[model samples]
Target chain A: MSLKNILSEKKDELLASWFDRILDTYPVETAKFLKNQKDRFANPVGQAIHKGIGDIFQELLQNGDIEKVSGFLDSIIRVRAVQEFSASQAVAFIFFLKSVIRDGLADISLTPELYDELATLESQIDSLALIAFDIFMQCREKLYDIKANEMKNMTYRLLQRANMVTEIKDAEKETNFIAIHKKEVNS
Target chain B: MAKLPKPEELLQINYNPPPTEDWMDRPVELKQGNFCWGAKGKNLAAVEFPNARDWTPVEADWKLPKDWEGTVLEAMADRLSKYRSFKVFMDICVRCGACADKCHFFIGGGDPKNMPVLRAELMRSVYRKYFTTAGKYLGKLAGARELDLNVLKEWWYYFYQCTECRRCSVFCPYGIDTAEITLMAREFTNLLGLNTDWISGPVANCYMKGNHLGLEPHAIMNSIEGMIDDIETITGIRINPSFNRKGAEILFVTPSGDLFADPGTFTAMGYMMLFHELGIDYTWSTYASEGGNFGFFTSNEMAKRLNAKIYAEAKRLGVKYIIGGECGHMWRVLNQYMDTWNGPADFMEVPKSPITGTVFDNAASTKMIHVTEFTADLIKNNKIKLDPSRNDDLVITYHDSCNTARGMGLLEEPRYIINSVCNKFHEMPDNTIRERTFCCGSGTGLNASENMEIRMRGGYPRANAVKFVRDKHGVNMLANICAIDRATLSASMDYWVPGVRVTGVHELVANALIMTGEKERETNLRGEPLPGKGGNE
Candidate 1:
């Protein structure tokens, strides 16, 4: 069986499984949104499915013609940055996706021979995604550490400057107070 | 100033009795010729790279006697283990080299090796060879070298050369601080009783006595009395800086050396003047006479013992607040280590400067403060009189000492004081300034005559920045808040930028102080009045 035919047969199972995994950790609103979107594309679902599946391949792998999917992935990563999710958290989120894919594969019915082939393909995909996730996390952590340390040092310098100004004021006051008192005593 | 004896002469002084058995088994090499010098002519500058060759190997029989072995050996073993333990941390680094350009020392000195990652690589390479399983098995394939006696000696020499300034951490992607490694190495070396007399003698003195300078109780009192008399002469303030006065509202703890030394003594006078102006109930503690922790140069135990006096004295005085004086590592040790290591004092209240009503929020987890912060707040609240004209001729530039600026994030307070008091103030280049500050080249007690080359090399980046300002803005005076910075930069200024002087930020403040009876404050050491008309000369 060709890869295209195989993916077509398991398309619904894949989508349903991914939706469930994402829904498990995410809020009900996000779950509902995905479900509603799925329902709207069910009529022309095969082509839509092909496109969505193609997108994931394009986004995850470097060479697939899945521009839309890659764009979506980029948006998600960028949004995660806005949320201030650390590189560690992002890597964990990717792992969550892999588990979802595994659970979805479990629900699909197929011949034993075909099922074995599919499982192998799934594992290969999982390995690729994990490697990519790890690399991204490492880079992110490095950048964040530098930024944080710089901020810390800058804050320290500011505090020291503030402390110096305080000392100057106190010194001036003492010098003036004594001078005034001395004058009054002399007069 | 007369030059001190050569390294050879100084080493033979029998300053402290040598340890009986020396664990060091490495050969000593002294290189002739000007190797690390930076400047030319009278300003002949170079950094002495203490390599494996400078250290002399000691016979096992010559090691500290068995009775002395417990403390010395255990301390050495502990430090060595720490050096070994940090191998995992050192090896785990992916060598992204993100920290390369981030170091002010690297940027200022233009020395690639000063880059934090590169500096760590020197130690990491040694660690990989000895400690890691991959290195043990694969050898050259795993990029590990053999850790020989020479390697150990090299580690002791080169590691001490680092100031333990955390400037490189600012650019490190993993927040890997070479400062921590430097401290660990120093601890290990000191345990073997292989310390330069300059730092070790002070550490031992601060440990056994109350102060690093070996100032007796009377000497400390007399110094304060002298400051009081100077205050009376300048401003007619007969304020007594009471020592060991129980139940004062504040226990003003300063680096004891400051009570005896120049510039620092002037800063001490500034503290007295401030305390008098605010009319606060504060006393100097004879017990905790020193805020400067030389233990920071060697072991944590020594650091803890030196730091213990402050709280103990604070408790004795029953003061609400303990204010620290101008010192670099003193603040770093206090802000970063003292609170957790020495624990808290329930007897003392959380510090609130009475003059400013500024309540410290335990931000750094310590109830103490840098004196500049206390006084800056008073000025902000309009509690003091300052004449900007007094500092008219001092085209001042501020040097952010690594400890105050990097360790504690205290950049603003000192600058605020400088801007308020000095009529003309210029800033050094932004990259080498503030949080990214370069060391004064002699931090971490590497200020000995032997280490002069390293100090000058480290100070090159800072000196260049000062030079840039002097060339462009005509900045002739460098104002800093750290005592070590004052000493280091004063030496650098003398050599690199002739006629440019260094003063504490407080000294500048004292100069601009507005005494009511006087027509104008004497802002400059030259006795020049504030520039322009109506300025009393």
Candidate 2:
């Protein structure tokens, strides 16, 4: 059988195993709470991971739109980016799926064509992990940008008070200095 | 050489925490992104706080007082004797774990110490060792420990981590106020000159300059003048607001944050427009310019001292009654502690709406009414006209500021005004709002940049609820009454749910209010185009 067929047949089992491995990153007590509290709104971090990985798995099996895959990856990685995880640790869950898929299909016999298909599937996961790394960096950049923006915002009125910030009127923008200089030169 | 393990065996990951019989055995690490910088000596000296010296929390030596232990214990004894409620909260917890998961910090950040019961136990264990009879003999068996430097560091770390939102108290069967314990712990820390610069700087500023932002009288006018200019641009009407004027009939007080910052600046513009439309007799006070008392985050005496200015300014201005602007902890202090702290405002009469003639008997004792309470009365009495279509672009949701919802029970008034002003309003899941509402995670002077990680962690649950509505209901605007909510929720929403923006309820009100002789409006308060007036259109 092909690797896609094998993955499709054992989809539910692989997804559960992958999710448990992803959750194992959090503290044990927190993992228990995240697992037991089933409400999506009440347990958002858990819900995001649970739903995110499933959507990603479906996309992988179908070789579907990369944008859809990135979107799902963004939702999960964004949570971990702001969390206590390093860059590699945040993207480590994608690698967990390889072990899950291999273990789920270990009992079956393999042909050369099936082995080649498995290599391709593993490469796709690696590609997904690369995309996850990009998303993690974007989230981190956004966080630092937010912190810098907040510092500026906190002192915004003080900046105004010290005559440091000026509000440029829209009418003044129409008469650009460069345009005026060009007109003067022509004259 | 050892034989190589199988791939599955190599892949196995352990999730369990290291085995420790007691949490007390885990030493505090004072991790980065978790704690704020220590209070500056200049700031403490400005307010004349005790043991005013330069210190760093990361340093091994805190430069504490020689008799710091005696200072803390003596202060504790004094507070225990002075306030029966403090003593009751100290001895009353049953350790039932009811409030363990209720704390936003605990729910969002997985550290077990973030749990409300364990956070309180940090203080309770020390109390048991000193005050309880069983602790002296049993020691570790009695769940008590010595209050050494390590314990003090733990107290500082955990107490400041709490935002004093009081979400845990709602779930506690005994109604144990965990926020109060944090407050007491902070008070002790202050005795050793241990205060976060975020809180102490503002406390000093409020004491000297009459606001946390330290705006001089002229600076306050300059900021308001800027808001007035924006109002003119949006509505083609010039609003003249007076500062520290006497006999104005009403005195307005609001958090200084509204006067500055995006989103918050828009909220300030909304307030001025609403007031100018009503043609009510009101004046802003540069003396009591800040409605939020940051000193409330420090010590009780400092809180009272800072809070005294409101009533003092009201009496001096000779206003009939006071109208307070949107703020979180300000209302907590105003509703629960103001009357007890600096009250008997017998000089000021009960707040009666000038336009609607509605008497605010709820604020009979305080003589100060929340602006929403005032505006809701106006809307109910049909005192002002509103075009809800002006806000057609926004799918709005109200986040109940923790202080206003739990401390004052002023729930329906903001909702009433929102319904009258906006076309779309959606309530987040019931468990995440009202008295059980999660904190902004950055309230009570913890809204500093250095601790953004923990702030985002604490804000995760609230952001999660907002994200739910943003996905399901297309909610793009978060409306709140608190100025800090306007400032901090903007950051949190941007981080967690990018499409959602934050606003004050009155910003929506001003957007919808149709003023007399006003030119056709194309933009809302922030100068953004109204629903159908976009550049594309």
Candidate 3:
């Protein structure tokens, strides 16, 4: 079957699996908040998901008809990462959506056999969510470490500079012409 | 021999108190005028001087160089740069006037010019007009007044009035220290060779000779020997305080004035006794013996050079750490400048005081541990046996020296030591204690006879506080750390309030300690036994 037909038949199952994989990482309250918010997902979240899923498909298959949907899902995770939402929080949010998607799929009167097929599709989404969460955490840690080291290095330098000036001052009672000259320039 | 008139009679010059009741009611601008001239319409020419012949302007002028005119502006600029911190502080002050009522001089003299902010403004206004861009262009618009001969004369008068005690900075929200301004002004005046002979002569002598009081190495040795003799008489401990001893664990640096003067030299002996009792290996370095930084009054380079000797001596002796003696500006310079300019001392260890076991962090930056702090910690930790009962009848009150209190935030250590050593410890009013403390009114080498009226006015508030304690609580003694405060307060107490004695905090601590061959130490003004006297067992 064509990729478009496959995705259309298994879209609900794919979303549900992705959601379940993300939910396992956060606390129960955050998982619940994400689930509730997903029920009424607004323009920003919808647009991000659409763009991300499209990009993912473009990279995965050059001529795949299912590229738009894959890019949309990819965009959702990438946008959430930049917002400083913790990896755990993002996972919990995806889990809530998975539970909602499961219920929605069940309400559609699909057969048990069809549901089994959908479960296979959901596993692919789960793998995608896990990979995105790992990348987000690694980037955040690197950024924080850089900032901390910069501050420490700056303080150490200032202390050294101050010490040099003090030594020159202590050596004699006469005015240090060098310090005086420097002072004139700075003023 | 006729006994000298009571300390009170010695300070009794014809001082007309400024109008106090009308002070708060008058406009701020009018108060500025009152500051410039002590009383309304009191001309500088009309002001009487009882001891004029020695300190007259003519005598001062005669001492100046032929090219003194060229050096005046150079000196002022040099001073402005030397105490660049002061210039930064002046520009930064928001004029909240929180430090207005805080100055003891302003409160006592009833002169608004004596107000820490106004006194600082006298130089700051001139600084703005001459140095800054906005002030140069906008002039009056920027509140920058031009520097003229009259302005120079006013600078000489009002700047001298300030003791550079830094009491105002404590209450200042932005830490706008006025002592920096006073030092800068003095530096400017000194550059023109227009210095009070009392201070400049000594400063020049210290520059040429190694000591402020012109004490030669032999004189210093003899002075220390004499102190050892006095200590032997008091406590029966015959200690030969080793000077310039190599490889000592610690190097003790003190003001040279202390080695020759009364009560101060006595206090020095007390430090020696404590060091001996503690069994700490410490030596006094004659080269760095003078801890008082007079260069702080004149030039930054001079200040640096003056301070350099101590570190140089410390390096030479290979001492583990250097300990400053009980002096004000010495601590300030040490606390603020020493570490920054002369450090990364790989050889000398950061001072881990043996008595307190408190490892001093930032020894180069706000890292100073005053002698009183060490003593207090030792007492608290039970390392030293102190008998408080020996100080009976000593109604002791502590006057926080501006340099120590405002510049260093050393409010509690001295008090903690005093309370631990003496039983009858009373605090002055809330306005005159701790961070809000007043100057002894004769700091920054202003203890000269020429600046008597200014000194008296500056010392007024502090004296009033002392008087308040005397009248209310029968307090008869003032304990302080700064040596200048001791001298200024001694003169002020003698003149303004009788029967009040001032001593270094360490003197009392030394008295309280259980020294060898002395079961009980003498009581101070209060009637309590000194610490370690008649205590348990």
Which candidate number maximizes TM-score?
2
lDDT of 1 by residue, B119-202 (tens): 666566655665578877887677666654454455655566578878777876777777887776666555555445566566
lDDT of 3 by residue, A1-187 (tens): 4333554566556554544444333233223333443311112233334334435434333342344434444345433443324455543443344454565566466566666655654554466556656655644443344334434433432333333222245456665423312334344
Clashes of each: 49, 0, 62
Q: Where in model 1 is the C-alpha error above 4 Å?
A: A1-187, B1-88, B100-115, B363-365, B516-537
Runs in model 3 lying further than 4 Å from the true structure: A1-187, B1-96, B131-142, B362-368, B517-537
DockQ of prediction 1: 0.01
For each candidate, what's the DockQ? 0.01, 0.38, 0.00
Candidate 2 to native Cα RMSD, angstroms: 4.8
Model 2 C-alpha lDDT per residue in residues B1-537, reported as the tens digit of each score: 999989998656443345544689889889777888999999999999998988999999999989899999899889889878789998999889889878887777777799899999999888888888888678878888888999999999999999999999999999899899999999999999999999999999999999998888988898889889888888899989888889999999999988877787787888889999999999999989999988998999999999999999998889999999989999999988989989988898998998888999998999999999999999999999899999998999999999999988989999999999998999999999999888999998999888888888889989999998999999999999998888889899989989999999889999999998788999988788987897623
Query: Which residue ranges in model 2 land beyond 4 Å of their true spot?
Result: A109-114, A167-187, B1-21, B534-537
Per-residue lDDT of B191 in model 1: 50
- Identify the leading candidate in terms of DockQ: 2
Clashes of 1: 49
Q: TM-scores of the first chain across all predictions? A: 0.44, 0.87, 0.43
Model 2 chain B, TM?
0.97
